[model samples]
Target chain A: MTINASKDLYAAVPDEQGRFGPYGGKFVSETLMAALAELEVVYSNLSTDKHFQQELDHDLQHYVGRPSPLYEAKRWSDSIGGARIYLKREDLNHTGAHKVNNTVGQALLAKHMGKKRVIAETGAGQHGVATATIAARLGLDCVVFMGETDIQRQALNVYRMKLLGAEVVSVTSGSRTLKDAMNEAMRDWVTNVDNTFYIIGTVAGPHPYPMLVRDFQCVIGREARAQSLAQTGRLPDALVACVGGGSNAIGLFHPFLHDESVAMYGVEAGGHGISTNQHAAPLTAGTPGVLHGNRTYLMQDSDGQIMDTHSISAGLDYPGVGPEHSWLKDIGRVNYVVANDDEALRAFHKLTKIEGIMPALETSHALAYAETLAATMTPEQTIIVNLSGRGDKDILTVAEIDGIVV
Target chain B: MSRIAGRFQQLAAQRRTALIPYIVAGDPSQDATVPLMHRMVESGADIIELGVPFSDPMSEGPVIQQAHERALANGMCLSRVLELVQEFRKSDDTTPLLLMGYANPVMYMGYKAFADAASAAGLDALITVDIPPEEVDDINAQLQRVDMDNIFLVAPTTPEERISRIAAGASGFIYYVSLKGVTGAGHLDMEEVTQRLAAIRRHSQLPLAVGFGIKDADSARAVAAVADGVVVGSALVNAMAQTLADGGNSGQAIEAVASLLGEIRQGIDSAAS
Candidate 1:
């Protein structure tokens, strides 16, 4: 289980047992173990298969609109007064976010496996919308379990999912939020394993899922790597991304891990602040324990009861991060930082005014940190911020927060 | 003798199937638990599976979910659940007690601490619904140090190779979930049960218990015809839920559940004849 720090980190990871240095492993029930094993074999075979790769590539190009452009944010960089900044335009994806990348990949897997239905648990409803979109395209029956609280906050996306022909199930469980939605989804998945595929939106579930999600999402890093060189004539000096379940962050960081020159910063949701016990910063404020499926840093109390996590953005409001992110954080390969609610709000406004790009509240956490970080770097250097999603889903939430009802 | 083995031996000697009923430890109230256990045994229960209320019981349906909510509302936790087992042992030492729940609470307490405390508290076995054989080996090793039994679940989708793998570490009898869905779901098809059990018997020498869909006396009899034991859960808890909805308390739950168990016992015995 020793990680060879000298070698390529990604290759060493998720070894035969799916351990990302004691963080990732299969911790599901017996009923799910077989399913995971089945998926592992299928994914392993298909990941290397040339036709499968080609089909995935074709879909990413024609269906999902991949190679999401890396745009240079000249105005925002000048306003910040330091390093030049570039935006990885994942917000431009068909569903207005990077979540569709992984969903398209998983829904394809479901089709390959002959599964007739797809189910997912959503937080801000972005993942739900993305999953519903893909399922609709593939003509698969889709069901989304969204927390009642989140469903209320993001009604527009909920309606979008209904338009896509997916059933939206309101979860009224503990906390009435993302974690409970996940619990209900797991329950549903365990029940309907025969003909259904549970398309986990993040890189944080049991074995093969975290690995598979990271693999599917690695396209971001892959495309960004090539795009950075083609645009800037070099790998960007630094990479910044928001970490909820850490899928988009990992997607954008994986290809750059072996490049010793690039610095990576993962900004977590510091709801109020880490010191105030109201943040969703597990890697920054919490300890390692098991939750969902894998062993990862979790925002849990001393008794192992998962604590309530908070953030203005529901997408970044999870108690646990991806297990690979935990391994990366421990190895010091990535600097894990935080941005509180106010800072993200300020960044949201700054991005909209300067760059004319309305960023999702979740992605604004990364932008907020990048604003201060760019101030310290040289002008010759560059940074790429993953604009993981658009702000369309959060307008009403923001409007209500600002006391403007409409 | 381990309580599970001893009870199975007694049941085999009498040529009767085990009628094991499940109940949440503090469903109505903690004070009502030990008495409820006694009443269930008085109505021909061979063993008792006491549910530890978890914040999320993913394998459960509406009935058991409400039972967990009620039990937690009554201040039931892992510590209190162990204390309830200690109380149950004071009067009844013969019936095997299994602490069935999810892995989080048990893991939160630390496996060694919880295992030692639960074994010392007279708990004979456990069935963590979420702890499969892969993730359970560490805890199984801990429980084995104390001679405790860690029961595993086998579903219809379980492959034979996996059944062998799960069977290796399993100490107590294997619980075969009768259907693909959660507890309190589906109607029992004895034909499917017979076929799945036949597949499971190839890899497991331990006694087999069928749960999940065994609802009434007729279904219980149908399951008991093939299984070594029939576990009835939501049916008993639903009885209590109905009684409480009717403005009744633990006294009424005791009567309703005992009556239900008595009928199931008769059905099981009659099926044997």
Candidate 2:
């Protein structure tokens, strides 16, 4: 059974040192200490600046196409007791995912800071593609590191990034996937800090990055709040989104977190089931530890070495989640759940056949959970699902599983 | 404060460039690395970067990766590497020691503990191969709280704006990759290194050390003419590899590499003079 949410969801571990429940703290060589201190100052200043917010808002609205619409799914809603359902169309954003919302904003910050190049790491290539798209727009040189294994899987996205004028580096390292890509990108950023800006894709990484990316993505919630209120006269009962690094989910859930009436569910990628070793559900079956810069729940071995996570959805292949989501789960602001591969596949086909919308496999996980949710709830309840990205990239994946031709 | 940074500032005030050297630690083992680092310091190394081995080094060339693989096989992790540094610290605490490695093991060990142990082990700085300058403090606050230099890398392909941002976040010395590719690639544009280093220096006063292709005394001396320091890795590793291939004592191979490093440092020092 899930424990009651703690009043102080965030347990103190490191005092005044930014440690997260004994999971976070700065561990680095002395050479980079002053740089961290300086970064802390710059980040704190940027966070409080109204002008920065306005500038980001202007870009998000016009350049990246903000205020994505919420569509009421009449057909899907009817099948599930005719309950009213709304879909937050973050999948419609430029670059075909909600990642652009944060990348464009962060790249703009880099430009404002007088930085010229942008760098990032990607697992499913959504973040890399998004970062590359913004770098092209800003006329900045961009580099994206992807795991060598992922390069073979998501080759189409790699080509798309190259087309966007971003250099895609194949990182052939440990596990040869997302984690290795992260390592390579980090190395590149450290090596090229002189004129480079790292656009972290998720709500992971260090404090300022997690906070900064969340703030940028908060547009999803800000707009969803206004749109939901206007369309339904109130907020939805449940907010559902897949939790691959927890960016899109947090984007929608952050604003609604404080609203007591709203319940949030984050669907993690459970490849087979929670019982199997092959799952990406870190919070449910994993422990609190560090991975990819932030101290959070990670799928790791007892020795604390990061474990290679498995997920049918390439985007949800990460072994860790955003630290904020971890805190939110602990505090009962959100309920973290898992959707298996078969369930996700069923949802993918259901949405594709019923609504004629083939969503990204990552989004299918949320839809799968929604299916279970709708069966138990009455028609009066409303569910707002975050369609994080389009399924164009996953055509090959779905085809292989379904035995369809390319 | 980085020894190279102080020296570079002095050189900047007097219109001079600095000289640096790079080596993969535990390449042959402590028998060679301990003395080799000392010899590099003695010869004329303004700063020395000691690479900690990992299972996979993405940015490194075949030569350097081989060296890393060998070192890993020789049982070199963060603790062992620090022990190597501690051994070197007995005679040369002032020569800045930069421990460059991946973040997994370091993060696994705990950030605060790693920082405390590294600081106590007498490390002057760190340059994680896969950590962005902005995210350095995520590991442990002590990396900055203890006033250690977090060196940043500046590559030939880096843009002006990024250079400024990295420079702003950089302390210790700024490492400038001499080429666009990984280490051990026999190609380098010395002119490009000079130009990129100059471009990076415009945004930062930190020492600019060039690496990735300076494999020999000649190449090291050439890069040192325009850069604050020269880093030689693959060439040294290659020489050591050759010795190991010959069934020669691995420690002797390290000594031989150190002797070559000393030659390169002397050559650069003479050229500067």
**Interface Cα RMSD in Å, per prediction:** 1.8, 6.9
The digit string of per-residue lDDT tens for model 1 on B1-273 reads 799988888888888999889999899888998899999999999999999887767778878988887887787888889998999899998889998987777888899999899989999999988777767778988899888988999987788888888887776798998887778987677898899899888887888999998889899889888899999999999998899899997799799999999999999998888
Runs in model 1 lying further than 4 Å from the true structure? A1-4
**Cα-based RMSD of candidate 2:** 7.5
Give lDDT tens digits, candidate 2, residues A370-391.
8788778888889899988988
TM-scores, all candidates, are 0.96, 0.70
The candidate maximizing lDDT is: 1
The true-versus-predicted C-alpha distance at residue B89 of model 1, in Å, is 1.4
What does DockQ give for each predicted structure?
Answer: 0.61, 0.11
Candidate 2 runs further than 4 Å off: A1-52, A78-84, A272-276, B1-235, B241-273
lDDT of 2 at B100: 78
Give the per-residue lDDT of model 2 (tens digit) for B159-201: 6777898888888778887765567766778777778888987
How far off is residue A266 in model 1, in Å? Answer: 1.8
